[model samples]
Target: MPTPSRIEHDAFGPVEIPSDRYWGAQTQRALGLFEIGEERFPAALIRAFGLQKYAAARANAQCGVLAPELASAIEKAAIELREGRWDDHFPLTIWQTGSGTQTNMNANEVIANRANQLLGQPLGTKTPVHPNDHVNRSQSSNDSFPTVMHVAAAIEVNGRLRPALDQLRSALAERSQAFADVLKVARTHLMDAVPMTMGQTFGTFAHQVSNALARMDDALPRLLVLPQGGTAAGTGLNAPAGFDGFFCATLSEVTGLPFVPSPHKFEGMAAHDALVELSGALNTIATSLLKIAIDIRFLASGPRCGLGELRIPDDGLTSSIMPGKRNPTIAEVLVQACFQVIGNHQTITIANASGNFELNVAKPVLVYNLLQSLRVLADSASVFARRCVRGIDVDREQLTTNVERSLLAVTALNPILGYDRVAQITATALRDRVTPRAAAIALGFLDGDEYDRLVQHPVNCLINYPTVNRAAGA
Candidate 1:
């Protein structure tokens, strides 16, 4: 085995970095250590790391950690990194980088090299503006990392999730109006319940989506309350007296995100309750979306072999071996992502609860799970809207057929025919394979005019049955 060559610069001096390794041995080692999943942190996260560093550089200049010239140099280097210059440095496999220390170091090394370059100095150099000493001065892993996490999630939610949700909401609203006249058999536990307009079904989706969007919006404030000033712990240790407020203000100015200092610094630095709580809100939205996806997919299942209530635009093979079968791939992914978000929530809860004080050791696990959750929710929202919600077309004829065939409609007969007689009529209709009207007539439960009146256009009977009417009354 040979020692790998290191990236050296005149400023920070020589670092014993591996030459043969694609990233570094440490990153490779971390990858081996944390073999979690196929789901990588979204690229948005890496870009956000750049944003934080960029903001920090500016703040560093203002705080006198670096003069304007050095700040400008560091800023230019950070912009390159932000524009995707040093993605290789982030190669520390997720496993060994618990708490994202490796990610922090990756940022440090990349910025150091880049800054050294801007200064017309050798690479790996940390002189004029050290990556950690000056560039990352007054900041700690606990603060900067979580700050990036919040910013990343906020950007995703604002730019991606909200737009996708708005699209879904609009689709549902359109469908509701379109489906207003189509009455169908509603199901509770997959059993025939009663009459509900197709429009009402779509309206339910819109309502749920509204709730989800509200939940997602609520998470913003919590996420905004970051620990940027809390260096290493609750106390702003090496930070200047007014640095905390100034640092937050600087972040706000750079990112356009309202980065407010937390009231409880100790709790903020020590616990990830904020992450878990905000993630839980995201999971709640995911859960709502899960229901939306399931209902849409089930409705769009089939024109023959399945519950063919609606038809979705086909894309590709959702199943491997099943020919002519178009699986609800988008809905499936949305539901699966919901499960993942929930699972990540559990991991975050367990991790946060495990810590004693001053720091949660599961920082990497927490942030990793959080990033996963944000990506899943963002991706799933688009999928659900684009693949399922937008392209849907109701099978109006099938809906009518299902509604007409349902013996549950005999409840309309109950008001005039009475429960006992209607029950007998229903049983007889089922046994004799005749219509409920026929059974009612044979049993002499009601005369022709009365039976005709009861089953006439749905609303007549509903008006007679006050309980059912009140329940379904629009």
Candidate 2:
């Protein structure tokens, strides 16, 4: 038997919507027309719509455009939507209309129907509250969609992504302090270069994360500026004079973020450059994280064979074929996550560029990719900081061995014995497979006492004193 559904009318005639659904004809029509992808808009975006609708109703009421009782009903319903009570009501895919008009209509219909239900009327009444006229009063899909986009993106970046990054940076800084006294051989172009504390290396990773945080701060202001007053075509056609200010004030009060009206509503509705800028910041973060993860994996490469200067935390995961093999699983996971964020950034860039004269048709896909990148990066960063960076252990013995065996330690002798002499000493050490100190002594360039004083001393060679003393057999 066919499930019971009621008829709802729109400009395109009647649509048979399910009686149990809070959505009306427009949302029902959208469900049939846009079936392109299974990727529905995320709950964050839906909640943002709820917040936008609630703010719009209150703003319209303040402007004397909507009745207080109607606004009260819409506000109650919109709050329920924002609090995720009606998430199922918004089932449109991200592949819908470029302006997100369908999803915007979906919000309007659900709120309007639910509002009527609260006003002692059944669903699909469109009586006390109409989706277009009352629920979406003083707003257009073009402006409203982008306004919520900014709201959702700003909230996620500040609340989720920033804290995760801070956690990772804190973990790295703690490790840097712990490793401050340990000397290790630095690498350039995958070859041993010179002596440096392991702390300095981890400090570099922390600085990269700090820079990413700075970029996020720089991009946040643009996200806070909204263009909600621009009713269709970037003109405040049917909206009241102070509706934009009222909406922004109400939105900021609810969201706890300082949202402001866009000075030029045309740019906000026409282009998603702010979101693209945030995506670029996310891309930089991905790039930084990828570098740090790859470096950690490389340093923790092998227990007995490769340059195992760092030890990865064992999570009981091992290779199936190779016995007793441990993997840098967390670092590898972070690396892959960063790769996805990078790819998402490219998608956002292309989508932003696809905008036309008055409005961008790629809003849904653009915001979808941006939010995915934010969520993945935030989750991956938190996991990496907890499971990997905090638990990482340095192999002091291996670091010492590699440092003592490196021919580049001769770099320290350059100022004392000119570059030519140091180069000759390095060549001899490589050829004879002897330590640089032994090569210098055998080349008659320096006696044992002199070589010890010139190259073995921590101050002269820039090595940590206690660690280098043991490595040099002092």
Give the top-scoring candidate (TM-score).
2
The residue-by-residue lDDT of candidate 1 on 65-121, one tens digit each, is: 667887787677777767876765676544543356667656765776677767787
Off by over 4 Å in 2: 458-474
Against the hidden true structure, what lDDT does model 1 obtain? 0.72
Report clashes for each candidate as comma-separated counts: 11, 1
lDDT of each: 0.72, 0.89
Looking at model 1, which ten-residue stretch has the lowest summed lDDT?
465-474
The per-residue C-alpha lDDT of model 1 at residue 447 equals 76
Tens digit of per-residue lDDT, candidate 2, span 303-361: 78888999878889888999987888899889999999999999999999998998988
Q: What lDDT does model 2 reach? A: 0.89
Residue 375 Cα positional deviation in candidate 1, in Å, after optimal superposition: 1.2
**Best by lDDT, which number?**
2
Report the alpha-carbon TM-score of model 2 versus the true structure: 0.95
